[model samples]
Target: MRKFSLYMASICLLFGCEETIDVELKDAPPAYVVDAWINDKMETQVIQLSLTQPYFDSSEPTPITGATVTVTSEGKTFSFTESQSGSYTWDPATSTDRIETVGSRYTLTVNVDGNEFMAESELRRVPPVDSIKFTFKEERNAFQPEGYYAEFLATDPVGPGDTYWIKAIKNGIPLNNPFDLNIAYDAGFNEGGNIDGVVFIQPIQDAVTPLNEDLDEIVPYKLGDSLHVEIHSITHEAFTFLQQVQIQTQRDGGFDEIFAEPLENVSSNIMMMNENPDVQVIGFFNVSSVSGRGRKLTE
Candidate 1:
């Protein structure tokens, strides 16, 4: 009875120390977000414009409509007409549609309500995806039961300063998780690694494989599953921006993230035309050369 009384008293003390404190956060103005990534694929290109919302708002982003968008490369301008709310698109007529000379800078301009925003990017070269192979595996654990695992194969170009974003699509659905983001600098990660002119490292080559339900590493895909992989060459600035975004969004909750530094806003390449920049633009613009290949698991 004495011990039970002490336990009750301890629980009361612990409960008494807990109190709900409402954190009053200051309101900040909204920033324009531009998601403009053009690739040299025989498909329609799209650019989405939207505004940022409050930190705690769980609603959809407010789209910016009635905006004029265009891209110019090698003295030739291609207009992007508004297709729907906040989405601007440009269609390619033929498979051999070439907007302009490669390796030249492409400038993007957006006008919204008399305010102008501009960004520039160069279409970098990309290497072809060689193949996608599947390997059979036995039941390893609950997360990774017996299934077929896939591996993407691609060789980087023989030049440094080349960066790529490896995109994986499973059964037509893109693997858009932050942890699935696979960006490469030359043949390895980051610049100045002295690694180039070779095949992509093992980890990157296998990035097309899907992750388990926990978003952790596990064997993904099975018999009759389909996988598509694409490599999109990106600019250095875009690479940096994506790197920062991945770092900020990819949190698994552990000791390493416990002492992590406070989150900072990722930098953007888009700039406004106003003298004081009344409305800031936060996003990246990149033109890329892409190579992709698909495979279906049958074994």
Candidate 2:
């Protein structure tokens, strides 16, 4: 069992949140896997490089070491040194300046093992979470307990296509199950509506609550429960990738699986710099701007 789910942990290279999910590969030959994404928060940023392994060989993904990784924005380049196996880091502790800025374009360059890959992303803006509030549900259904349920209040900026990944953190842990993953378009889900510049819609807002371990039931917060909500502004491409992932990785079993579409690879933004068109890389790179709020559920 890996630490967490979503493309973020396995991919922390996924959303790069220091959590990882269990992913099993099929009978394909090994390919380079780049789990790289970054944020505008002033902290140590990371990019992970690895190689895909056998489906049954579930120790850990083999690390791709000794790679030169750098991110350049507005002509200034920040180098990431390999801090550990396959994981590279750029610490801003020495300097007060952060690497990325909102609306600025960023370029990623990776050179290793006679292969070079390049990618580009823009640091997008995020709407701030005004507050987190919880309400006590007096009725206990078969689905959930009679306790406090939490939701955050924050309006999407007055614009279209403002995609966001809403992370619901309870206590000290992230509710990062594959089913727990929640993303929004504008102020809602993909319903083909112009729902911008408003607080997040019901389903999207309600997703802050997580499901049980089996992913079969909802778990509400209780008295004294700590609730933290974060909005990670992602690219439209990253949004689409997550959309596909949530669809593909959903745990709906039985008849659902029978009628499900054949599994295929999700998309990636990382690509080879040279014309070695045969090599396939998996993963994405997005420069995100995050906004958040936190508090506890009290009586």
Candidate 3:
């Protein structure tokens, strides 16, 4: 009887009980997504509208059309014309001298199918990039042998709540990876560092380099590679939004399976004026003053 029980136990360990449970996932109604931005430049401002799709659906989100868009600031209103299917443009060349000014607040309003959404942002001043420096170092677990990387030398203005978004362009190609998203809450290396009025720290400086998507590694630049860095003064809300986006992008298979942030919608500045609960909106509206500098890597 003991031998028979042992054999049964072995069998159970090898091929235990199994069952398939059916999960019914109800698809939520589609919501509108708005991508709006206004920079301190003498150019046309653009607003893009689209509808969100299901998670498993592999198609592009449908664009919203026939919407009326307008931007207002300091008692002046500039209307936008639909230039494409889902794109609206406000050309300051035709109506005004410039659309955005430093320290000026702007409000955006969009009316679609009798539903109205509004957002407001201010164009803040960005510190200029004094210079860019590159160095090659050999370190443990490095991707390349004494890989080359660039850093910006710029002093952050003395302020507690100042935020910046740094963008890197390599040979005229913009780096758009989540790993390449570089943002600074203050002059410090990370949040609450309080290293104000000084040069940005090493960790923040190293973020200017691009990353390899396949291996999830930082890619170093080669000699003669042209690098352009643009630093934009962003609102605290915009900084928070980009931080959340970075978290979402970094959470992949293993880490995501073990410890992952709960899936939540990104915060949007746009709001429905009618207080309609049924209508959902996504994305953000941003206004920024940009400062940039470029350099060619050598040695």
How many clashing residue pairs are found in candidate 2? Answer: 9
For model 2, the local distance difference test gives 0.83
Worst 10 residues of 1 by lDDT: 93-102
Instruction: Kindly indicate the candidate among 1 and 3 with the higher lDDT.
Output: 1
Per-model TM against the reference: 0.89, 0.88, 0.86
Determine which window of 10 residues in candidate 3 has minimal summed lDDT.
250-259
The residue pairs that clash in candidate 3, if any, are none
**What tens-digit string does per-residue lDDT give for candidate 2 at 1-299?**
33334323334443535543455655877889988888877788999999987757778899999999999887687899999999999888865557556889888999988899988888888998998878888757778777778888889899798888889889989987899889998998963878989988888888898888877668888787898898998989989989999988875775356467767788999989777766777889988898888998776
Name model 3 segments beyond 4 Å from true. Answer: 1-24, 139-145, 189-191
Candidate 2, residue 93: how far the Cα is off, in Å: 1.8
For each candidate, what is the lDDT? 0.84, 0.83, 0.81
Off by over 4 Å in 2: 1-26
TM-score, candidate number 3: 0.86
**Model 3 C-alpha lDDT versus the unseen true structure:** 0.81
RMSD to the hidden true structure, all candidates: 6.1, 9.5, 6.4
Q: Model 3, 1-299: lDDT tens per residue?
A: 65775466555556774344343557899998999876766677888999998877889789899999988889888888899999999777787546557778889999997899999988886888888888886754655445787788777887677788888899999988767888887776356777777777777777788778764566888898989988888888998888888777765564233357766777888888887778898889888888899999875
Q: Give every collision pair in model 1.
A: none
Ranked candidates (lDDT, high to low): 1, 2, 3
With candidate 3 superimposed using the best TM-score fit, by how many Å does residue 290's alpha carbon deviate from the native? 0.4
Error in Å for residue 266 of model 1: 0.5
Ranking by TM-score: 1, 2, 3
